[model samples]
Each structure stands twice: as structure tokens, then as C-alpha cells.
Target: MKKGFIFDLDGVITDTAKYHYLAWKDLASSIGIEIDLVFNEQLKGISRMDSLERILVHGGKEQAFTLAEKEALAHQKNTHYVELLQALTPADLLPGVKAFLDEARKNAIPCAIASASKNAPFILDKLEVTDYFNVIVDPATLKKGKPDPEIFLKAAELLGISAKEAIGFEDAQAGLDGIKAANMFAVGVFSGEELHGADLLVERLDELDVLDLIRR
Candidate 1:
């Protein structure tokens, strides 16, 4: 039986990917890095620092950045992202996300959020979905990001559940990898190709029957 649910915050819980893409595009343009949305996809479920490094490397100009220069540019991008997120409203939430959380809670299944964003708590609070989770494993508490499994594992630990009993819901490929690494069942949302490590894939959150999914 399922005991817990670990959710990814960005594309899975809130529609923040567009804002992140815009911020990264702004930063890339400022630094002459020439990053596009395709390149930005590589940064999903990754830390801002790691994302910047990968963006620079992919753009074939990583060596051009000094530590200080990288920090300044990444900070600038964060400023843009935070400003954009300030306009976040409840309507920005993904379809069926709220209902899923509500149903999970009603069913007595524990729910938690595991996100690479250091701003995870802030975004959750803004969306007013924080109360739906019993615990949240965010960037602030973890040294490693997704694909490492530490974040998802920590969420399971916090919810007092075994990894096998926790289902991880994620939108990014990295997050799927993390769930696999943690020995949990992964339910991939949004994209099909990104569900490489997931046990199942759904185009929309509400499309999946939670009880039926857990059975498989």
C-alpha cells in the first residue's frame, strides 16, 4: 500500500518553467551564451549554480567565466525569476494538481514536496499548497540536487515511509532518475520522452487514477 507522495514543484505543481526559461534566456543573452529553450531543458531539476555551469558549457564558453562572474550572472537571472514569480496567482497552478493533493489528503496518504528550487517554499506558500504537504524536502535542506536521489529520499524519510512505499511524481527527466535511484515508483507527468525512468507516464495530472497507478 502507498504511504506517501513526493512531488516536484516546478512543472508538476506550479507552472514556473516558463518564467525560469525567460530568466535563463535573459541571462544567456546578457552573457552572450546563446541559450534556447531546448538548452534550457537540460537545466530542469538542477540547481541554479549547476544550471549556469551547464548552460555555459553547452554554449561552448564555460572557460570564459570566472567564479565571481558566474555568481553575478546567476544572481541576475535569479532576480529576474523572483520578479516574475511575484505575479504568480492561484490560477497558474497546473490542472488537477490541487484536486490530486486534496484527494491524497482525504485518502490519508501523506504528501510531501521535493524540489530543486531553493525558492520551493516561497512558491508553495504563494500557491497556497504548502498546507497540503506534511513535509517538504527542498534545496535548502539538501546538498545534492536531482539525479542524486538525496532530495526524494529525504522526503520519504521525513514522511516516515520506506522508499518502496512512496510514489514520486515528477515532470523532469532528472527527477525521474532521482526517484529510480531512491527505489521508489516514479509517475512522470508532462512529457513522454522524459519518463524514461518512470514506471508510468501521463500527459496530465488528473488523467492518472492514483489508486490504479499505485496498484501497478
Candidate 2:
């Protein structure tokens, strides 16, 4: 069977989650909305607008922002995130990820990024690994977010492979849900949490043979 690989960006590719946390933290504070890492957990694998809405709910400020104000606030957080991402380097590729990308190339499997983050392209460019992906899903073009199958389905479409022939790797519950919903095999990269729904779960990418994830 032909196979393709799809990856989620933030936690799966690099550690930009810290930058995401810090940026969101700054945004919340600027608005008098106190937030902590625990609250930030809700933002994972979700779109920026959805994440901002979640933060608003946590701060009890959801009703305070008008549609225009909400958009402006989300833009503010994104600007902060882009600033934080400026420091990324090739070393920022998660341990073993580059090797796996190389392995995919060696084995002739197509790869794509299926992430909820709008800054995915910027980060990939900063890391100098933009060439690895056959397609990078543009979050701005999507009407739905993770836990919805749209992102992975779109990725598989771009790869010209059926969802059943693609393997997706993710580090969050919502991502796993979306991968499975798309009828693709799912692998969860453990990031300290007990992610329960993947077809296969491993602590890191190096633990699994790339060929196994790719075919059979």
C-alpha cells in the first residue's frame, strides 16, 4: 500500500508550546485576565481564535469582547507568538525528528504538516526544514479545528493518498481524535501526558521504525 506521513507542528515538531504559553500569558495579563500553565493546557491543538475564546472563558471576560475586539486580541497574541518564534534554530527540531524526516525521504514517502498553528510555516522556515513537507496546511483556510477531521483530511488530499493509507503522528488528544476520524493510523508522541487514543503510542519518534509507521 502507498503511504504518507502527517505531523502536528507545535509539540510534535518543536517546543514552541513554551512560546505559545508565554505569548498567551502576556495577552491575558494585558487584559487583566490571570492565566497559568494549567489554563494554557486547554489551548493545545486548538486554533488561535478558539484558544483566545477559551482564555476569555477562563478569565470570565468572554462576554466583554465584541467580534472586532476578539479579532484584534487574537492578532495581538499572534504578533507576540511570532516574536517568540524568532529565536528558533535548526537545533529546535524535536529530538529525532530530523532523522525521521530524512528517513521518510530515503524511503520515498510523502510528508505533510497538519497543524492547528498559523505560525507553522514561520517556525518551519526558521528551523530550515520547510522543504520536508509536501504541503503545509494553512490554518487560516480552515473553518474547523482539531478534534474535527478537516485538517488531516486536507493533508491526505494534498498528498494524493487515501486517509487509510496515511499515518499521522501527534502529541495531543485532540490531534489523535482528528487523525482517527480521518480514517488514518495514528501514533501519539508522548509528551508527559498519558495520551490514550492512538493506534500506536511511543515516547518518542526514534522508538519506532519509520518504515513501520509508513507501511504495513
Candidate 3:
């Protein structure tokens, strides 16, 4: 039985991906690089610095900036992203999110956020669901990002559960891979065909019964 839940924040909880894309797009443009929604998809479930590094490499400017310069660029992108996030409201919570959360809460299931986003807390606050989570694993504290299992394992640990007893929800393949690597049941929340190894796949969370999932 799954004793706890771990979720990816951006695409799983809310649609911060747009804001991220916009911020990155602007930053890339300023640096004489161009990125589209397709390219932005690769940035999902990764750290800001890693995403920036990818963007730099995509633009053929990977070695053009020093570590300090890269940090500054990442900061600039975050500043813009944060500004965009101010527009988020509880209404922005994705389809079936609140209902699923409520179901988990009713059953006393511990829930933790295991997102790549450093702005997870801020986004949670904006969505007015800060109290719903038992833990929010800090990406800054993790040495490795998604596809490494570190974040998911840390979240399960913080929730006082074994990784095998936790269920992880993600919209990105990297996050799904991480959950599986952590020995947790992987729940994929995307319509894409790429999430091949998920234990369960849904276009959205509401399609799955919370109690049923936990009992599996």
C-alpha cells in the first residue's frame, strides 16, 4: 500500500510552465538565442541553473559565461518568472487538483512536493494550498535533480516513509524516471506517449481515485 504521496509542482500542480517558458524565452532572446515551446519542454523538471546551462548550450554560448555570470543570468530569469507568478490564484489550480488533495487529506495521507522548482513554496502560497503539503523538498538541498531519484527519496524520507511506500506524481519523464529509480510507484500526468514506464498514466489527477490508488 502506498502510505504517502510526492508530487511535482509546476505541471502537476499548476501551469507555471508558461511563466517559465516566457522568462526563459525573454532571457534567451536577450542573449541572442531563440527558444520555442518545444525547446522549453526539455527544461521541465530540472533546476534553474541546469535549464540555463541547457539554454546556453542550445544557443552555442555554453562556454561564453563564467559561473558567476551564469548565476546572474539564472537570477534574471527567476526575477521575471516570479513577477509572472504574482498573477497566480487559487483558481489557477489545475483540473482535479483540489479534489484529489482533499481526498488525500481526508484519508490522512501525507503529501510532499518533490519539484525541481526553487519557487515551489511561492507557487504553493500563490495557489493558496500551502497547508496541504506535509513537506516541500528543497531543490537547492539536492545534489542531483530529476532522473536521479534524490529528490523523490528525500521527500519520502521527510514524510517518514520508505521510498517503496510512496507514490510519485509527475508530468515529466525525468520525474517519472526518478520515482521509479527511488522504488516508488510512478504516476504520470501527461498526454504524451513518452511516459512509457509509469505504473499509472493519466491526463489529469482526478481520473484516478485517491483511495483506489493508495490501496493498489
lDDT string for model 2 (1-216, tens) is 648999999788898989989999999999999889887788889998899999999889989989999999999998988988889999998998888888888898999999998788889999999998999999778889999999999999999999998999999899999999999889899886679779888876778787766656
The 10-residue segment of model 1 with minimum total lDDT is 190-199
Off by over 4 Å in 3: 191-193
Backbone clashes, candidate 2: 0
Better of 1 and 3 by lDDT: 3
Best-first order by lDDT = 3, 2, 1
Against the true structure, whose TM-score is highest? 3
| Top candidate, metric lDDT | 3
lDDT score, candidate 1: 0.85
Give the winner by TM-score: 2 or 3.
3
> Candidate 1, TM-score vs. the true structure?
0.93
RMSD of 3: 0.9
Per-model TM-score on C-alpha atoms: 0.93, 0.97, 0.98
Ranking by TM-score: 3, 2, 1
- Between 2 and 3, whose lDDT is larger? 3
Clashing pairs for model 1 are: none
Candidate 1 deviant stretches above 4 angstroms: 213-216
